[model samples]
Target: MSPLHRLGLATARHPWRTVVAWLFALVALGGLASVGGGEFQDNWNVPDTRAQAGVEELRDHLPDAGGSSAQVVLHDDHRLEAAVVHEVVADLRSTDHVTTVTPRLSEDGDTALLYVRYDVPTTDPAIYEDISGLEHATDAAADAGYEVEYGGELPGTATSLQGRGELIGILVALVLLVIAFGAVLAAGLPIATAVGGLAAGSSGIALLAGIMDVSTSAPTIATMVGLGVGIDYALLILTRHVERLRAGDAPVDAAARATATAGRAVLGAGVTVLVSLMGLRLAGLPTYDAFGFATAIAVVCVMAAALTLVPALCALAGRRLLPRKERRAPEVSRLGAGAPRSSTTGIVETREVKEPLTARWATTVAKRPVAWALLALTILLALGAPALGMRTWPQDGGSDPKDSTTRAAYDLVADEFGPGANGPITLVADLDTVDRAEVKQVHADVAGLPGIAESGPVTYSPDGKLAVWDVEPTTSPIDERTTDLLASLRSDVLPEGVDATGYTPLLSDISDLLGQRLWLVVGFVVVLSVVLLALMFRSVVVPIKAALMNLLSIAAAYGVVTLVFQHGYGASLLGIDHAVPVSSWVPILMFAVLFGLSMDYEVFLLSAVHDDWLDTGDAQGSVVRGLSRTGRVISVAAAIMVAVFLGFASEPAVVVKMLGVGLAAAVALDATVVRMVLVPATMTLLGKWNWYWPFSSVVEVRGAPAPSLETSDDERDDLEEVAR
Candidate 1:
């Protein structure tokens, strides 16, 4: 027996031991996490950008002003008392890691702004603690009858994973499972394995956070992927095991065979997902690297659970995995049309065998392949049209919930001051290299720029080697016009020695970097996926076709996201008040993730089709049989994925919401239009060419006798003609 078969047999024979071991591992990991886990932080430090150089220059020459900063906005019906503002400033100054606190009152006298700067990088865990202390200090203002809120990098540096989305996704998955399997025990097996894997994977991410800069969103993203794939892999294996039971195999043997077959496909699919995710590293951003690493860890844990825990559960469930009617009926020969021999139940009523709906649908497509292909293509292209106008920017405080302190602070700052006040572009120059006269001239030019609302006097470092200029734009941080202004400043206004660095300008730099590298990541993922598919199927045409179809589905999903989130098509329904650019990192991350996920269905369907083709030597017949056999399972699996993803789509974070919607849309399209209609139609048209291989000699082509069918002689003849 193969190693996978042996593994399956061993686990099924000792189900209790397997279950106990998994439980122990989960507990141990959880314990380790609780003890060693670190707080999550966002890192947008792009190394090669002009913004990064500017930051480095500041850090080298001006230690006091080189750290991250945030704003405390206080509002009252009357002018703020000087004593109260002084007390708040003293409190902030005493906060840990706080280096400077500057207070300014609005001309209207109703609002006050405190600038609090910390002596640590925004990615440091201490920064979160600092924000907490700042918030606590600002609470005194609230006690004095003033409304207070926080804004800027320090306040917006954290990403939260807290939401009802994950729970809802799991519940929806369980419901879908029960409906699909027709037995609670069988359905629960997948859920149990999935949850076990998710718990362990989440714990693993916590541990990973201690060692590296893991983003707070990593755990949530990991959970989203791990839960979906964990359930999916287990379900695939369990389905095969139950099929084997119906075919009269012993529980151990059935589980072993199922593992040898379906488990192989799961292994391939899992590896593909891992490889695709790792492609995120190529983007050369620390945040993207963290995303790739954290999510990959989750996928690995879940895949291992599916491969090992699923067989044990299947063996334990035994005949209970089958439906009530199937349990009472005698084992029917799956290879031939045979009457039931006997039954445990006294009444052995027989029912006519009708053709499966999937099989009939396949036959219809085969009859008019060209029309079906055209219809699927047109739908995909139309859905993908909106992608042409897609725009992307990094998430800003403005995207936070309306009630959130960060959002309130953002709005207050924009209202009290100009909108540009919220995102001041800092210009740093090395006085040793650039003349002070030239620096002054650059400042004057920037002030006269079209988008410039205000410009501050140049402040020289104590060492006299560094000078900094602050310029406020006439637009919000995420505004395209702000980006244009920054570009003009870099390209025309600012001289070579002056570098722009601030929250807004830094995010713009990061967005530009991601946009430039997006195509390279796509190419890497697509080419690698194609090669993997070709190796698995041993057919050139199959992999190419699979890649093309997957691309179409992804494009359609992108279009949907652009329309809903960027164009405000249905933004209100998702709680978004206005159109916003898609998150800059989302499309790159989504492409890597969705491409791998789309492959799961491809492997599931193509593996079955390849097996059927090897068995019958009739290409068209195999396509019909494969679809008939796996269509329901694939559809249910896709539905579960959709439900899980849609759950996350309802999250408050726009980036998370965009990713959730994009992934869900792609899966829905891939499973429906691509898998059901397009795949069958295209395969029917390809005929014998679908199996063409340059190295066919290495593959064993079986010429076994065709299996007996439930169809009438006339129907069989028609199918054979279509196959020819």
Candidate 2:
């Protein structure tokens, strides 16, 4: 027996031991997390950018102004009390990590802005806790009849892994499982296995955070992926095991066979996911790297559970995994009335059940492959058209929920001061490399620029080797005009050795970097996936085709995101009232994720097809039989993923919602149009060439009878003609 088969058999033989071991591991990890876990902090370390260089200079030369900062927005609807404002500023200045506090009133004098600077970067773990002092100081202003809100890093840094969305997704998944499996206990097994995996994986992330700069958003992203894949993997294995039992095999033998078959596909699918995610490292951003690392850990743990825990659970469930009516009936081989049984596990007996609806559909497509293939291609292309116009920017507090303090603060700042007041640019000059007089001249000249709404006086660093000037533009941070202004400043305006930094400039730089490297990341991920799929399936054409199909799915998803978010087509339904640029890194992240996920369905379907091809030696017949066997299961898995992702689409954060919606759309399309319609049609067109690979071992089975399908005489003739 193969290693996977042996492992499955061993676990099935001692089901309780496996269960107990998994439980102990989960509890131990949970305890470790509770005692020693470290807080997650985002590290957006883009070293090559000018904005990053400016930030580094600030940190080195001016520690007080170098650290993260926040804006305290105060409004009174009438003239504000000077004493209360000063009192609040005094408390903030004494707060821990507070280095500088500058207060400025609006032109109308009804609003005031407190610019508070800290002594640490926004990614520092201590900053989140220390910011509470600033928040507490604001309470004094609130008590004095002034409305207070926070902008910048203050409100955007908070993170949470718990929410109603996760619960709702799991509940929806359970309902779908029951409908698909027709047995509550069987449906519950996947849920149990997935939860076990999710718990262990989350604890692992907590442990990882203790050592590295894991982002606060990592856990939520990891959970979303792990939970969906975990359940789908288990469902694939359980479905095969139950099919084996109904074929009259002993439970242990059934579980072993299922693992040997479906387990291999699951392993391959998990590897593809990991490979695609790890490709994020090529983006050369630490934040993206951490994202890949955290999500990969989740996938690894869940995949392990699916491969091991699932078999044990299946053994425990036994006949209960089948429906009540089916379990009560006598065991019989679906192959035929007198099919021989083998002692060794293998595909010696092929199932000959009546024609399933999927089989009929596949046959119909096979008879008219060109028409069906063209239809699928057209739909995919049409859906993907909008991606050509996608505009990307890093998400900011401007996209926060309207009720949030951050959004209120952002709006207030934009309204009272010009919109440019919300995001200012800091110019830093390195005196060691540039003339100090020239720096002052450039600073003075910038104020007269067309986009400049206002400019602050130049302030020299304590060392006199560094000078800083803050400038505000006339447009909002996300505006195309603002992006053009930044580009102009960097390429044509700023003198040598002088660089710009600030939240807005930093976002623009990050967006530019991601845009420049987007194609490289896509190429890396696609090439790697194609190579891996080629090795796993041992067919060049299959892997290449799979890659193309996956790209189509991802593009379609991107188009949908562009339509919904950038065009404001249906943004209000998702709680976003205005059009926002697609989050800069979201597409790369989505491409990497979708490529791997789309492969899951491909692997499952192809595994079954390859098995039938080896047995019957008929390419067309194998496609029909494979689709018939695995179609319902693939649909269920896709539906579960869509439901889980849609739950996250309801998130308060725009980036999370974009990810959720994009993933859901891709999975739904891959499972239905690509896998169901296009795959069958395209494979029929390829015929025997589908398995052509000179480097791989080739098997020949001559004059072998194909599996039976229940169809009318006319339909049978058409299928036979297509097979010929």
Best by TM-score: 2
lDDT score for residue 241 of model 1: 86
Residue runs of model 2 more than 4 Å from their true location after superposition: 31-37, 159-162, 333-354, 696-698, 701-724
Q: How many residue pairs clash (N, CA or C atoms closer than 3 angstroms) in each of the candidate models, in the order given?
A: 0, 1
Q: Model 2 over residues 156-208: C-alpha lDDT tens digits? A: 77633337568878899999989887999988998888888988999999988
Tens digit of lDDT per residue, candidate 1, span 150-179?
888888755465577778788898898888
**Cα miss at 562, model 2 (Å)?**
0.6
User: How does model 2 score by TM-score?
Assistant: 0.94
Cα lDDT for residue 716, candidate 2: 40
Clash pairs for candidate 1: none
